[model samples]
Target: MPVIAVLALDGVPGHELTGPGMCFGTAARHHPHVAYELRYCTAPGFRGTGSPAPFRIDTPWGLEGLADADTVLLPGHAGFRDEPEPEVADALRAAADRGSRIGAFGTGTFTLAATGLLDRCRAATGRQYAAELARRHPRVEVDPEGAVVDADPFHSAAGVLGGLDLCLHLITLDHGVPVAIETERQVFMQLHAPAGAEDATGPAIRHGTGPHSLGPTIRWMEAHLDHPLTLNDIADHAGLTVRGLNRRFRAETGLSPLQYLLRARVQAAQRLLERGDEPVERIATRTGLGTPANLRHHFQHHTGTGPRIYRTAFRSMVAALTWADGKHAEPAEPDGPAGADTDPGPSGSADDRRAARRRT
Candidate 1:
């Protein structure tokens, strides 16, 4: 289990503290086998600077909690303009020296910058505070647009909600895309969707055949994954020239048409591998990859693992989550080999898993 230590300071934003807690807590609920231990710590005599609300929060640990942390998060506080205590700075430095990942959000970037770890690194905070952040820390590159900047062990996000985005990114790093998506869906369900609508598993993408909307074209591409689709064919279907399609795709999806197609195929293959006992060659054929060798190359590129290994890891994780849910009398293990008699009992449909994976 990875340990996340949240450095709670005086006046820390309640949302900042709760955001990460909620994210990591959701991951634990869905994937207990790889859960993270969340620890909140404070310096001696510390009292949070209550803003949006007036309140006081007491923590269970001290600066020492950061010593063995896998990741340390610093949430925004009211006194961010002021320098952190010598002990706080020293503790952050020590954690970084030991290879712990450090993250900050909103004006908390100022506190992390004060520790000198962000020197010569790109960082972000609320857009309004970007100029002041750069002015105060000449050595640090501050992005005014407030995009999330990940400088290896040090990461920072732009605003309060950006803090949640940062936490979700960390979840993706620690537990893979599927787990992160599930956690994100859970969070959104609590925030936006009404009760009894939580089990919805439709593709988040909207579909339309009009020139202005690629949703329908993307959906078409997904449905025709087994066909050998050329850029020209896709462009023709979208009523755009090759160059126009490329531009529009990059603008809307951040991926070129062919890149999107390849990812779709890979995703299709992953779903099949997870849900059924199909041979690699058949899966490759069904997903339009042409050959098992081709599938191996692209699957490894996208997932950082071969199909067999990915299937094993994925199924084991699913089984663990299922067993933890008390859905079975005995904890189930993944079926042995491709042709074995195995039961993938009660795992949600491939569409559900795909929806969860693509939520982020």
Candidate 2:
């Protein structure tokens, strides 16, 4: 049985803390042998605060939980004014060093990123916080997409229920896609969430000239992953000759334009697979990978799995997608220090607070 240690920090969001509890609990109950034992740990002091401790947490599970766990889950809170207390950050770093798969529910991703494990890794976080997560951790590839973001050892989500996606994905990774799909059928009463990139950071491309020459163009390619876009069209928009675009794009983003486009298409195709919608052929066309044969060509070439099975195993949200609203979503500093409270936290009983978000 894999023991999942969920860290309870001061001011941790109740929903963020509880979402994993419910889904993983369901997994354990249904799966049995591969069941997960969920542990909750608190920080040093809690009960002394006047009005709900800001996080609605009166008691935390303490330091010991980090030592014995298969997976470590970090739930983000609004108070991200700085990196966690030294001991807390150390424990998080230690967990990362131990080969334990590290997870962050929301802004909690920032915590894990601070541990240096996220450098150059792709990931996701709460919609309200996508910008900051990217800016604060420049080395980490923070997906502006929605719902869920994942890069192996590290996984994150956009809003409340994203925790469900994370747990379901873990099941797939641990057991098999078939088992995960079955579990989703049992819990979601729907097919598994789409695979590929999430839209959490959907369209949330970082603006400005620094990478505008490069980042903006790549961002555009990512968005059109589902639409039909030609290299010439992309070059025109980027204001470069096809050859120039190819050269500059590769030098700047480390990928040729077509290569990057293909990657985005594959990622989108994965998400489509997870959504369980549209026939594979249409999904391929929609994502610009084109035809079952073409999709198979790229998907098999890149991921080693055909589209259907890949969706069953690894799909989450639209990969690298920032929601449409995120484009104009309220602007924030894009970086909050430890203990800084930027957004509103959850409230009510633990269960209600956890369920408050339907699919944020």
> Against the true structure, whose TM-score is highest?
1
For all candidates in order, the CA lDDT equals 0.73, 0.62
Q: Where does candidate 2 stray beyond 4 Å?
A: 46-60, 189-360
lDDT string, candidate 2, 1-360, tens digits: 688888776566555566677676655544433467788877665332121223454333577788878898887654564777788888877877788888786667777787777898887776556667777888988765434555767876654443666676677678765455545433432223246543321221122246346766766777677667888899888998999988887665566778778866876675566555578988977887768999998888866668777655443222212122123222356445554334423312212222322222
Q: Candidate 1 on 174-247: residue-level lDDT in tens?
A: 76776666665556434433465542222222233355778778878988999999999999998999999999
* Model 1 misplaced regions, further than 4 Å: 193-360
- Scanning candidate 1 in windows of ten residues, the lowest lDDT window is 324-333
The pairs that clash in candidate 1 are: 10-48, 10-49, 11-48, 11-49, 208-216
- Candidate 1: C-alpha RMSD after superposition: 20.5
